[model samples]
Target: MSAFSDSEIAGLKVARQSPLIILQPEFVVRAFTLNERLLVCNPNGRLDAEGALQHAYFSDFTDV
Candidate 1:
């Protein structure tokens, strides 16, 4: 059988749909492919200097 049949293709399309939503100026949401997400989310992954600094700065603030 083929890898993806007609019904499976339709489900895949639905699963990949992303809807835009607005957030506060300081916050953002992004979408990534499975591999990209895995790399970024990996426990062993390291953040670059700039990213680390930004994360540190943001870590000090609370929404309230």
Candidate 2:
């Protein structure tokens, strides 16, 4: 997947039919995984935003 800036948040639409893994330039590839939640990381395994998975899944299934 390509990298996106926070500024592009407006046009960003993630597909919920499948899971999405968004990695920061600092994290290791193996550092990303799905544990019933969204995981964001930096050079050190840090959490930028959690619950992203929830939002995507809900939005996909929602009427809105």
Candidate 3:
């Protein structure tokens, strides 16, 4: 990812599959791996990629 601040990210535009919508959140981003797996930031936190997807926190922010 580029060295962009949270504000910069939020100001930028990102295309979504549902062309009618967009996700330009103004907050810190959660990094992910090349294989589309979320990186583990906390050892005690949920470490399962498959499990994380089931949570409500999961969002379709993956850039096409």
Residue 50 in model 3: lDDT: 60
lDDT scores for all predictions?
0.46, 0.41, 0.46
Per-residue CA lDDT of model 1 for 1-64, tens digit only, reads 4657766876764455453444332333322222343467656675555554445335544541
Candidate 1 residue 15 Cα shift, in angstroms, is: 8.0
Question: On a 0 to 100 scale, what is the lDDT of residue 10 in model 3?
Answer: 82
* lDDT for predicted candidate 2 compared with the true structure: 0.41
Q: How many residue pairs clash in each candidate?
A: 0, 0, 0
> What's the best-to-worst order under TM-score?
1, 3, 2
Residue pairs that clash (backbone atoms under 3 angstroms), model 2: none
Clashing pairs in 3: none
- Kindly list the per-residue Cα lDDT of model 2 for residues 4-52, writing each as its tens digit: 6555775878866633344333232323333223443452453234444
Shift in Å, residue 34, candidate 1 = 24
- Model 2: residues >4 Å from true position, as ranges? 1-7, 17-64
Listed per candidate, the RMSD to the true structure in angstroms reads: 11.2, 17.3, 13.5
Where is model 3 more than 4 Å wrong at Cα?
Answer: 1-23, 26-37, 41-46, 57-64
Positional deviation of residue 61's Cα in model 2 after best superposition, in angstroms: 36
